[model samples]
Target: MVDLTALLADLAAESAQLDALVVALPPDAWRRPTPAPGWTIAHQIAHLAWTDHVARLAATDPAAFYGSVIAAPDPARLVDDGAAEFLAPSARLLARWRSGRTALAEALAAVPPGEKLPWYGTRMSATSMATARIMETWAHGEDVAEALGVTRTPTARLRHVAHLGFRTLGHGFAAHGRAAPTAPVRVTLTAPDGSTWAFGPADAADQVAGPALDFCLLVTQRRHRADLALVATGPTADEWLDVAQAFAGPPGAGRKPGAGRRAGARA
Candidate 1:
């Protein structure tokens, strides 16, 4: 069984870190555009709050969760005023996010072990669900942090994000409408603690090796893969980096290497 307690703790810690950054931002900084085009820092926080609430519903009531998201008033404006209150006082919105995430943790705890919870695209176990939340928190946190020119120290917790990134390699390809190559690919990432974390079949001819930070950044769509130090061997693996995404949903038009660094929404 997955350790729900530990997973929740980790997710909360990441949330708190992002919260601290938001708390310290100047009022004007809140309006500054993040890497995600059309999404300001405030928008990022708002989206997080909205998603947390959605996560809670998914955990506690799968039917309603699907109904609401599928029938939302306007999917295009879900991140704007149509979803959560994006213009609420920053402090209040942040508190709501904190509270919602806590509620999500509680709901997840009530889930029967091994039973999957419904999410945006597929069902997720409590463990996978929590980790997905963590990944979203961290990835969006990067957009907020980068907008403020903040550089955070990478941590071992990133291993969860990295694991997700590696696990989703095929999803990334499939999401892009490409048939994922069946050939085996290996990943060797140097963790923040200097430990090596590797994935994929041993002696696999195809491989990706790089710093965990870059891997996480790539999968999160926070940075263009070409600008990072990550190396990919084999043609398929190499091309995969161009569109790598640890996230679900439609294949994102990833950041262009050396393109406008300050543009784009944190999709």
Candidate 2:
């Protein structure tokens, strides 16, 4: 069984990492535009806080969770709207994010065994919900870091993000209005510590191999697939890389091929 406590601990660490990045920014810095078009650093943090608040509701009061968020009149604009709704002054936004994430962790921990929490379109176990939170926190942190010209060092915590990337292959296809391929696609990535992290069938005909960080960036739509170093063998695997999305939603427009490159070099 997945250790909910351990997952929550990781979630806390991920949130804290992002919090540290923004907590000390000058009030004017909060308005700096991130890679996500019009969204600023403050929007990134607000989005996290908004999601955490709704997720807390999911774990504590499912009815309110659905009624408040899932039932929004315009589901397509829900994400952007949530960020706008939650946007606040830097100090207030930071405090709200910190307190909200803590409450989310407590609520997730108290969820009954075998219970599934309602989400954007589906239900998730407490562990899965926590993992998703970590993924978003890390992904959005990338935006914040990039906005400040910072390149974060990858860590083993990415194992969770990579796992989710692989598991959501079908959802990625569905979100793009494409039928998911049935062929097994094996993925082998070199972790931050130089250990191998493999997923899918060992004998699968299709395969993807690369650094775990690149794969996570690809699936999260944080970077264009071409900007990543991943190699895909076979048609299905190759196509999968193009439309890979780890988060639930419509297919993201993603970054341009060279948009996320570091100073004078590819990321």
TM-score of each: 0.93, 0.96
**Model 2 spans with C-alpha error above 4 angstroms:** 261-267
Q: Global CA lDDT of candidate 1, please?
A: 0.82
For model 1, residues 1-267, the per-residue Cα lDDT tens digits are 558888888998999899888887677788888888777888888888887788788888889998987887776565564234645676777778778888988898888888888876788888898898899889888888888898998878898899899889888888888889888889999999899999998798889999999998889887787678899999878978976778767766668878535644354
User: Each candidate's lDDT (Cα)?
Assistant: 0.82, 0.89
Once fitted onto the true fold, the runs of candidate 1 whose alpha carbons sit more than 4 angstroms away are 73-87
Candidate with maximal lDDT: 2
Model number with the top TM-score: 2
TM accuracy, model 2: 0.96
